[model samples]
Target: MSKPPATILASVKQTASVIFLHGLGDVGASWLEAFNTYRIPKAVPHVKFIFPNAPIQRVTLNMGMPMPTWFDIHGLDQNAKEDQPGIEKSSKYLSDLIEEEIKGGISPERIMVGGFSMGGAVAIHAALTSPHTLGGVLALSTWLPLSTTFPKALISGDKKVNLPILQCHGDQDSMVQVQWARLTEQGIKAMGFKQYTFKEYRNMEHSSCNEEMEDVSKFIVQNLPKVD
Candidate 1:
């Protein structure tokens, strides 16, 4: 399938790129607003931001209602039914986007992949299976999907180490409980992923705030390739 169209925010002198996926029922344009609200472009100059739209499909959790989602949501439980095929497909799509960045002169090490909610789930899946070492992964307001299979799916050893991962979730997030995020951290650690940080915010729900965005900015600045 052809990749979904994106809302591109090109930098004056692009050296690195960030491919961010939107949550269920959201378009790339929506994230563009969030990025603008946070002034992300100014915070991280010379970095292209690509917000890709998820393909529209029937979401099982919503009673087979059609929506733009990274993958199907079979249930809410951590180990509930997962749409493995959809996850794999979206991961391949993400890889293709990364490859396109490489073709445009950005190294895989200079590219970061991230998302919100369901989108974050896809980002985690993609990063875990990626053949190339990414600069980092920003997963916000989300939980790891297919948790039971993650241990066996990880790349293992040094390849998985030193890859920065910023996971921020709300303590009051009813959509994806904070405990789920904790479990995700434990699973990744068990797989020998050392460079991971899980940040929790009080009273925050299934959404992000200015504080979270600030941390996100810091993560981008810290992970992106340093200039001489």
Candidate 2:
């Protein structure tokens, strides 16, 4: 099924892009509003922001309920069964989006993919499995989706192993807990992606805070600086 186009915040002199994904049950515009709240768009006027909407799908975790989800989540625990096909489908979609940006003249090194929770999981998968090297990936309060398949996935996919990564989590995150982020941090390192940083926010739950957004802004500009 064809979903709506992303909520775009095009730059006047666009040279770089940050294709960010929102959390489950969230529209791109909602995170677009969050970016506005944090002045992320203002922080980097040269960077075009593309927030794509996830297709509605059934989530087993939610009792077979359908919502705007990139993939179906079986459960919240780390050992829970993963929907590989669903995740890979979204990964391909995201990689295609990145390819489109590259075809439009933005270099691979000038593009980033990011998301929250489930979307963050997709971002990590799509970015790592992509054949091209990219600017970076912002994985917020999310874990590595198919952890058991890593290194193997990395080997067979002919993936890009080198790129900066920023992973942030909340110590008080009730939805996606802090331990999962820790495991993901270790998982990312074990997979040979060394340029990753894990930041923890105090007193923050399963949501964004001003400090976290500020860090995100810094990451975007630092990786995709003004080229104009």
Candidate 3:
């Protein structure tokens, strides 16, 4: 029997515009509460949301415990990388999910891709390198992975597209170093990314904050392509 395709949880309305990928271990359902509590109320009339779960893998931080992850952690003492087959598969899976969303009446320009932690890295990588330029990208406490094509994408310029990205990280985040976030922001800006937003919340840990989420809402409303 063929394996079942990964499921993505969506909001009540077909207003699906933004697609969210969750961090390691946490399921897509974990995002629903945040969406309902924060993003839904400020919902732009036609903007819908999608949360896709990463496949299961062995996480280094969790004592090599096998859980849902976009890529393998490899070793506890090492950093995150996208060199493994699982990582590539997960990336392609995310790409396919975006394609599916497009076929369901959501234009690439109308779709925003985002996530927390590891999910954030995946979203950022996929959005930056994808053939189609997404509407916007929200990466919360996420960093740029090592195996990205940012250099080529940089030299290519924003010819085919220019996307606005919203990235947030915590100064007190122990999981992903705060400096990495800064590096990601600096690198993207240097690469001719004129429309990117970065936020570093003081004293916050490795999770989302009300203010950051609020900024996300504003950014989403602001950057969405104006429909005629």
lDDT, residue 28, model 3: 80
Candidate No. with top lDDT: 2
Candidate 1 lDDT tens digits, 72-145: 98888766788989988988898898999999999888999999998898898888888888989999998777
* Model 3 stretches with alpha carbons more than 4 Å out: 1-16, 39-42, 75-84, 153-157, 225-228
Model 2: lDDT to the true structure: 0.87
Which portions of model 1 show Cα errors greater than 4 Å?
Answer: 1-4, 225-228
Q: Tell me the deviation in Å of residue 62 in model 3.
A: 2.8
How far off is residue 74 in model 1, in Å? Answer: 1.5
- Span of 10 residues, lowest total lDDT, candidate 2: 153-162
| Candidate that beats the other on lDDT, 1 or 2, i.e. the better one | 2
lDDT digits (tens) for residues 1-228 of candidate 3 = 012333334334544477788888887878857877785534565666667766676777578888888887754223544445655566667778789888987778778888898888888777876777778889899887753566674323564237888889999998887988998888777776768888999999999889998898888778773454
Question: Model 3 reaches what TM-score against the true structure?
Answer: 0.85
Quantify all predictions' global Cα lDDT against the true fold. 0.85, 0.87, 0.74
- Model 2 / residue 164 / CA error / Å: 0.6
| Cα deviation of 32, candidate 2, in Å | 0.6
